[model samples]
Target chain A: MEKTYKVEGMTCGGCVQSVEKAINAVAPAATVKVDLENNHVTVTGIEDDNLVAQAVENAGFDYEGPVF
Target chain B: MEKTYKVEGMTCGGCVQSVEKAINAVAPAATVKVDLENNHVTVTGIEDDNLVAQAVENAGFDYEGPVF
Candidate 1:
């Protein structure tokens, strides 16, 4: 399943890398893309919302949970 | 001079705090505010741009220099 989440604190390319790393840490099979302008992160192959949320939080980002 | 900088990697309130602390560390008298909506940070009371940039970088953030 794919989920779109609202993440906060990302301000650049490095930030995008960090967010990707954080998400991949918990779900190695997941693919993440960040929309910096919109503060949205779309992930594929990750169904556990809590897992993704925890990863984002542990990386010091604001995870506003799954978009829908 | 009051300067506004394009900062990257700040995604949350904690990030804002981190940025503020980093700036204050180098210039204790300076004031820092993170504009998450626009990825901009406006600072006052610090005349040295290099000092502020260094502080932000050392804190693991991307400092894109002053806006104007």
Candidate 2:
């Protein structure tokens, strides 16, 4: 399954990388794509959205819930 | 004096607050303002740019030198 969520506070490439890493750290099997321009992160192969969201928050970014 | 710096890995209000606290921690008299749209942090009343830069990095963000 794939889910797209809004992530806030990312401004640079490093932030994008950090977000991706954070997502992966929580869901090792998931693939993460971060749209720096859109502030959205599309994650695939993850079953738990809350885990991914926690990963984002733990990494110091705002996990603005999920993008329906 | 005021200087605007480019900081990476900031996403959300918490990141902004963390950045501000990090800056003030190093330079107690300085003030910090974060522009989420611009990806810039404008700081005032700080004497050492290097110190400020270090502070940003210490806060776990990528400090891309300065906006000069």
Candidate 3:
């Protein structure tokens, strides 16, 4: 399953890296892509919304979705 | 002045902190609030959309707005 989340509070490249690292840590095989200009996060593999949400929350940013 | 940005790529609380830090570093006086469940970021004391965008981008996440 692929999921895309709308996120908030990011402010730079480091924030992107942090979000990626945090997600990868929890969802090892999850493929994550971010479009800072547009504020979108697309993830592939594993459909646990809670896990995905926790990953973003744990990383310190607000996230909303499964927007699909 | 206040601004809200939709962000992407966060997966944990740490990501939130990182994003906040990144924004503060650049804007200093800017106040930021993130609502993960809603995917919203509220920022105050700044009116520069570019700077806000840059802050989020630098923090390593994707962002969109000034959404009012």
Candidate 4:
């Protein structure tokens, strides 16, 4: 399944890269993409909400769960 | 200055505590309060937007700048 989250605390390209790396580390098969300008992150993989949430938290950004 | 940010990706009290600690570590005099239910973080201290943003980023939560 795929999910898109509204993220906060990201200011630059580095932040986006960090978040993506964190998510992939936890779910290697997941596809993650972050839009820094829009503050959105989309992920596709097995549904593991906790792992996803932790990845965002670990990267130092706040992540609200799937908005839609 | 005091600012309130809307944070995302926080799932539990532990997330809240982790965020608070990270902020304090960077700015010792800053006061940070996280509302897990509301997903809000209020900070009071000298205004340093970058530091605040970095602190939130370091904690692994997405933080949007002062909502109000």
Candidate 5:
């Protein structure tokens, strides 16, 4: 499964890498990609929304949950 | 003067950019650089601590004031 989230406060490549690392830690098999220009992060191979959210927060960014 | 802040929630380049922009908006002359590996942001040319904090929060990240 795949999901997209609108993360606020991402402004550079470092944020892109941070979000990916954080999510990957929570969902090891998940492939994470961040569209910094859009402030959205897409994760594949993960279905647990709560876990993803937690990881996002833990990583120091605001995760507004999957974008509809 | 220069100040180093320990900001929480920065995870990638986007974060670095966001923080920089946020701070710059408040202190246009401020030179902001974020070290993702250390989760720290160094700002030069600005001296208002409260303003910096507000900018960080407004940027969606926790700004724990200049690192002692």
Candidate 6:
């Protein structure tokens, strides 16, 4: 399953990488895409919202819940 | 006055610049310094938290309130 979440704390390309790494660490099989322009993170293969959210927070970004 | 806000969404130097520019746009005279290492923004010469926070949101980042 693929899910997109509204996240904060990313500013540039580096931040984009961080967000991807952070999410991938938790969901190794998931493909994480960081949209810096919209502050959105799309994770494919993750089913648990808490898991992804935790990873995002651990990476220092605030997870403002999922993007509907 | 100098105020440090706990900002999120910055991952690299480019993010640092974006954050600075976002804040500076709101307060033209403010010296906005972005600390990517700590995800903090030190803005000098601004007094209204609302203004700074608004600028951040307008710049496409999430404003998670002030880091007091």
Off by over 4 Å in 2: B1-68
Candidate 4 regions with alpha-carbon error over 4 angstroms: B1-68
The numbered model that scores best in DockQ is 5
Best by lDDT: 1
Q: By lDDT, is 3 or 4 better?
A: 4
Off by over 4 Å in 3: B1-16, B19-68
Could you report the DockQ of all the candidates, in the order they appear? Answer: 0.07, 0.09, 0.13, 0.07, 0.17, 0.13
Q: If you assessed candidate 1 against the hidden native complex, which CAPRI class would it receive?
A: incorrect
Root-mean-square deviation of every model: 8.2, 7.1, 11.7, 10.8, 8.6, 10.2
Report the C-alpha lDDT of model 2 over B8-62, residue by residue, as the tens digit: 7777666676577667776789989999777899999987889877766655577
Q: What C-alpha lDDT, on a 0 to 100 scale, does residue B51 get in candidate 6?
A: 88
Per prediction, fnat is 0.04, 0.04, 0.25, 0.09, 0.30, 0.27
Alpha-carbon deviation at A62 in model 2, angstroms? 0.5
lDDT of 4 by residue, B1-68 (tens): 78888887666655666677668777879898888788888899948777877767655567677777
Each candidate structure's count of clashing pairs: 4, 4, 48, 16, 13, 5
In model 4, state the lDDT of residue A26.
72
Instruction: Give the candidate order by descending TM-score.
Output: 5, 2, 6, 1, 3, 4
Interface RMSD score of candidate 1: 6.4
Q: What is the TM-score of each candidate against the true structure?
A: 0.52, 0.52, 0.51, 0.50, 0.53, 0.52
Q: What is the per-residue lDDT of model 1 for residues A1-68, given as tens digits with 9 covering 90 to 100?
A: 77799988777666676678767867888999999899999999987888878767655568897777
Worst 10 residues of 1 chain B by lDDT: B13-22
As a TM-score, model 6 comes out at 0.52
DockQ of 2: 0.09
Candidate 1 clashing pairs, residues 3+ apart or interchain? A8-B11, A9-B10, A9-B11, A11-B9
TM-score for candidate 1, please give it: 0.52
